[model samples]
Target: MANKTAPLTDTEIRQAKAKEKEYNLGDGKGLLLRIKPNGSKLWLFNYQRPYTKKRAVLSVGSYPEVSLKQARQTRLKYRELLANDVDPKDYKQEQEAQAKEALTNTFEHVANLWLESKRDTITSGHFQQVKRSLEKDLFPSLGKKPISTLKATSFITLLRSIEAKGSLETVKRLSQRINNIMNYAVNYGLIEVNPAQAIGEVFKKPKKKHYPTLKPEQLPDLMKALNTASIQLQTRCLIEWQLHTITRPSEASGTKWSEIDFKQKTWTIPAERMKSRIEHIIPLSEQALALLDIMKSINGNRQHVFSSRINPKKPMNSATANVALKRMGFRGVLVSHGLRALASTTLNEQGFNSDVIEACLAHIDKNEVRKAYNRSTYLEQRIKVMTWWSEHIESTSQNHLLTTKKSRLKVVT
Candidate 1:
């Protein structure tokens, strides 16, 4: 038989609590109220897990805050969740824990921790580069979202936007940083999986082959135009070194005073900071060395070799070289990146061994013999090659000599 239903009232509720020892009121459907021997009233919901007879007691809020109406609402909500194949009480607890944790586990919070942890291990300039990439590329889109809610598709969109702008390599590196950041989050138990790991499936990477190289005879005109343009000195030097050293602009921009050995005429790029994650020894030509000397007067006390004109503490923006070239009326004619290809093609045409040229470029030693002996980066040959190219640049820049019309016509042909 069902218990008689009674309209809930403040007085009746109070009396019900006071007289609970004598008579317990049951809500007639697994809900019941208990008045403890100590006279405390607790609202309890009794239910069975769907398809199982295991009964469970769900603690509803205590008396006043969860008045009879609020308690009834909670009970109904839980029943609704159960009817929909969800465990309401378990989900409720899970959500509460997630909310409490989200207060402490924000994207910035995790990213800061990740950056700080890597600061000492990574070079100062590389530290700044990663920070910049995140600020420019990742943060605007996903920085505020909870790390837990970052889905693979969301990260794919971020990388795709960068690729659309013609920065495919940047997309790969950014994906790695994102993966690393999420891995850090995972280490701290903030997230279970790295959403950035799914980038291979979501994004299309252009097949890797050699980048296009510029010819030797074209170098003189290119160098002359870049130097005579009204670009800043730092931008000029960065482009010049990018050509002479055959290093990535990131590597060139991030160079430090400590890495250069003026006496030995070598620049040792450390493993942690190198894109290859292996220490790279670059042989500096007199021309590249001279450029560094000029920068010293400007950036001697600063930590970075190519300090920003506006902010000495940070390195020159990675795009400054390319941007300056574009503004100098060389749009599409050259890029900072084209310098690497320029050196490779010029050196190869000049009869230098391909392995030596590759080594000079600080490329990973994929050749078994070269990789085995670590006899890559033959400094003497590189110095000679770079010096020869440097002389060619200085002579051509000084004399404003254009390639002969015959050569230009041949190029067009």
Candidate 2:
């Protein structure tokens, strides 16, 4: 129960200054209004918790700044938290600790710290995936360099070296990774400008390569084999989800249970996790909805859809799906990510409008006039084209309905 006593008047407050037990004066039960012998009042809260067996003191406010009504309200909120099986003291302590940690987390320091902290947040398996690229390819070459000194030219040269190695795709993703690091550095106030900006302008993007897609005749047997593969349930779901919606394998694999909007049949990916720093809205196909329904039956409560068997909090290692393809004897015949290439190439070869294809791949077309004038990826046209492509892939893969019929692609978006 809360105290119902009247607030101490100024004369009473002055009188209390002369007594020892009543030296402190305040309206709240725990908050003490300490009166200076010369007549000044300060408010404080005294309490104890059983777990630590520690007595803690909290200062409410001083004199007129913290009125009798205001100090009482603060006490009520804290008591309510304690009554509801919560520990207000513990909550405050944790908040203080987090603030302290965040204070020390400077840009240069936390760049390394962010990578290390993710070790527990991600898996050893996924950690190895990120480590090989960050350490062997990236960090060793540029890790110690101060972020402020990293110029656009130096950043481009670093990528060009990797591009020279025949991994055009790696170059693309490396640009993304470098941008992520620079963005992290920006958050920690290490740098004002991102060296990775205008990356597309800085480096020549390789001609988009085609993925080795299964011919229309191959879909049924592949689906059947996938259905019966004991260890590949999660992988199959991830693959089907990507195919049905034309999403990147990484985006599909990292789908958080919360990001799914089942009612709207959409998956909105945040820009931070995307290759482009733009939010991507993937309009789900019916096939995608079905796959999500099946996925929910198995891993509904977990954070990630394709969580590692060892760690349920993080997504499965990127290699897991690709490696499974190898084990199933589809290594050279098929690839986990080749699906995107397959979709883009086959759709173009089939003669769909180029704008539709670009929209499907989330590619933006820019020209001096159009670039300045048109910015939206026309969802109306894109929706129709993507639906047709989904139907085409599904039809060919399942029933071997091969079509040489083609449409001229016009990149209008």
Per-candidate TM-scores read 0.61, 0.49
Per-residue lDDT of model 2, residues 135-178, tens digit only: 77776667766566677777788888877787888888778767
Which RMSD values do the candidates have, in order? 8.2, 18.1
Best by TM-score: 1
lDDT of each: 0.74, 0.67
Q: Can you tell me which runs of candidate 2 are displaced by over 4 Å? A: 1-134, 137-221, 224-230, 368-377, 396-413
Q: Write candidate 1's Cα lDDT for 1-413 as tens digits.
A: 95575645656667864553534456645556666766677777888877665788888866766687777887888888788877767878998999878776777668878999987676666788889888888888888887887788878877777888888778878888888888999998888778777676556675685533456787767767775788777778788777777788788888888899989988998887676667888777667788888888889899889998788887887778778877876676677877888867766766777767776776767767867554533766666666666655555565322221111110100
Candidate 2 deviates by what RMSD?
18.1
Poorest stretch of ten by lDDT in candidate 2: 398-407
After the best TM-score superposition of candidate 2, give how far the Cα of residue 8 lies from its true spot, in angstroms: 88
Best by lDDT: 1
The C-alpha stretches of model 1 lying farther than 4 A from their native spots are 1-41, 45-58, 62-99, 111-146, 149-213, 226-238, 250-259, 269-279, 289-320, 366-372, 375-377, 391-413
In angstroms, give how far residue 70 of model 2 lies from its true place: 75
